[model samples]
Target chain A: MNLGVDLTFLEFLASLPALVEWNDFTVGLVAFAVKFAILVGGLLQLPPLLVWIERRVPALMQRRRGPNRVGFFKWRLYGLMQSLADTIKLIFKEEVVPDGAHKVFYHLAPVFCVFPAFLVACAIPYGPDLLVFGHKIPLSVVRLDVGFLFILAISSLAVYGVSLAGWASNNKYSLMGSLRASAQMISYEIPLGMSLIPIVLIYGTLDLGKIVEAQTSLIHWGVFAAPFSFMIFLICMFAETNRAPFDLAEAEGELVAGFHTEYNSAKFAAFFLGEYVSMFVLSCLAATVFFGGWQVPFVPYETIVALAGSPNIAALAGIMMLLLKASFFMWVYIWVRWTLPRFRYDQLMSLGWKFMLPIGLANVVGTAVVLAVLRFK
Target chain B: MNPYIPVIIVLIFGVLLGSILSGLAAFLGPKKYLKEKMDPYECGVPKVTSGSEKMSVKFYLTAILFILFDIETVFLYLWARTFDQLGWLGVVEVAMFVLVLVVGYIYVLKRGALEWD
Candidate 1:
């Protein structure tokens, strides 16, 4: 018996540019595919790594060994492989659909939870535009004119997942958890939006890439220009992600597993992945907006080009720098998560409305006043 | 090459990934349906009432407040983006808009709409 495999598809993929009309648009499509792969692939890979980091950091903080058993024979690397093991276990575990549950919605909630996380990543520029085959291509998957607003609007839809999951479970705790989660998200979202108003005021653009490009020098970063708004935005980021000390939705002491009480196996894993993805996206946004995204502090573009000997190398270095900053913020998330206790529901609500709202409002007015003064001068 | 193409692609990817994972679990995992196991959890005791019962009105109040403030913030974003072009007039307009919201906010606080207890 002779078996022959067809290699035509592989050949066709290699010959795509030649087979199709080689124009700017077609070349752009190819470039976009590569950029999309890099962005999505990079983001998808992060959740597992974040899971590992989250576990290890808390263990180190608490003086207990985290997951020291999963790696290859005797070289555990402090349980770095635990996330992998957990993924496998979750995938193989039993998935239960509670009797009398809303069948369609029960399945739909996890999808809703996970989708927005990926969608938000599309707008974030991972690095400066790269020159590919003499053509300039943006590092972001999508560079919308209103990149910031797109991110905010899409990320807000994430609340639907928790609310729907809680309601569909037909469980009291889940319902309460969803209610708290939705309420907290909506409440904090005001400050989140308001805090960014000052950044837009200073940057004068809603496009995140343009905002980053404006911060060519270290002093031009939004953090230094508007420290108050940065502080408020950082606080809101924590609350928006359902992280400590604002993670009342999943406060195990009171609400069991909260909105995810009924989820099992992969569905449960989906929510877990979504949370980590959201954390990463928020960190990236913070780095891009408040900090100089992909900008090596004090290093000019010409300096980077001279040091790297090529623009592509410089762009890669910029990408690494951006990732470094974003990762630091992600580490902060874990650090805060392990250190702080969850807030009481009453305290949480009051903090969002009474304290944060007023401060955010005042910050906006202050920013406006300062900007107006500068313009007149 | 539309700017939104990547967003649509990412969205489709997310939906597919989510569906595949959930479907895989449903297909691969063991099926054991027990009446006790399927019931909505309430510690170890029987649930007092259905989970779908009416919740507190405070949630509604919070939602209303959110819509009001969130819309104001959106307006702020628009004004902020174009603040330079609009100059002092824009700042004054936004200030007036915010003053109106502050009044509403104070009224919300006085009514105890935000108080959980």
Candidate 2:
């Protein structure tokens, strides 16, 4: 594996027969299992961290100390376990099934919502390689050629789950919330998809690993090469995840509790967890795709990799750097949510169709012209 | 290259297992004959059964139209995937398709198919 370049498990596996080791698929599967286990374990902590961030940061911005009283006196500053306590409290709360709600669809909605995030994570390459039974095993779960498209399709599916949840709830408010969410998701998806095109065009590949690798070449980092597309992507991603400024569906002043209004207990928790996880995943994706994934900017690849002593250590460092970058994005999300006020529904729609869409189109044209000129030169 | 057979087998097995379990549960579960539970209640009023229901066809028509356009978008995805092999001509073809769809959308907007009374 090259330093500062993203390499998926399959790419490593394809080169493995030349290297001296290796029995068959069993080692590969076990390595994959380990990577997946770690990803899930690490990912589970994000919601707790996000909860603490969301609760505390908003208070800081508003000139108050939020969640300070919840933690032990010694740990008052950190109140990290406040989210854990909240989870336990939510779990023990009585589950309620509202009358006239479509029982099947209502029950299925949370499962639908959560699964997409999990599936999308499979394409995300976290580390370089795993050491299993004295053999080096590649770390990613799976890599598809159409990984980017797969994520996009999964995002689209999330809207269906939300829509079904709202429509099946049989409540007027729930229906309205779902309707708003569906429209918002569909509208944002256009720009989100469009914004991705310039990067894809620049990289000349739809595979996410390849996209990240393209960025490691220094000059090819999509953000620097095409700033307009990056901006469009960032704004669209915010709207896509239904964060503040674009969270009309969950606008508490308008729709009470939104699509999950009648939901309770674990089902409600599932929706909440799914939302936070999706938010984390989107931020991670933005970091990886546009900001050059795990690569340290301006530092030559050889210097870091040589200092790290081996490809394995270099890969581990890459994973850590990627996680750090992703966490920073998560913090930024909390910061923005607290800092910014919500947009009116009309403003949100206009931003999507009237502004972001045209800009995204322009970015694609601009990228093509630049690439063509470079080729000609 | 073909992962189709295994995928199909898994799908079939899943559907069969789900159907059997749910079917058996429905059959074996306690069958309590209750009047209130069986009857359709709208705002707690006992509903008179069986009549030619007065519902507008427009709602159903719009839903059908939405489904059609949604499926057309799926075809557009396929075109996108193969666009490189099809070259600039493929781009033009897709543009034409999207243009036609936009025209249809405009027509529907003018006709107020999207409006909810």
- Top model by TM-score, which number? 1
Q: How do the residues A253-297 of candidate 2 rate in per-residue lDDT, one tens digit apiece?
A: 878767877676566767776788888888878888888887767
In candidate 2, position A69 carries an lDDT of 58
Judge candidate 1 at residue A249 and give its lDDT: 96
What tens-digit string does per-residue lDDT give for candidate 2 at B1-117? Answer: 232332243334333432332233234334455656443223355645321233345435534664555465456555545545665665556657666766876676677655543
User: How many steric clashes between backbone atoms does each model show?
Assistant: 0, 0
Judged by DockQ cut-offs, the docking class of candidate 2 is: incorrect
lDDT of 1 by residue, A90-176 (tens): 988888788868999999999989889888988898888888777888888888999999999999999999899999999999999
Question: When superposed on Cα atoms, how far off is each prediction in RMSD?
Answer: 2.2, 9.4
Supply the DockQ value of model 1.
Answer: 0.79
Off by over 4 Å in 2: A1-22, A72-74, A129-136, B1-117
lDDT of each: 0.88, 0.67
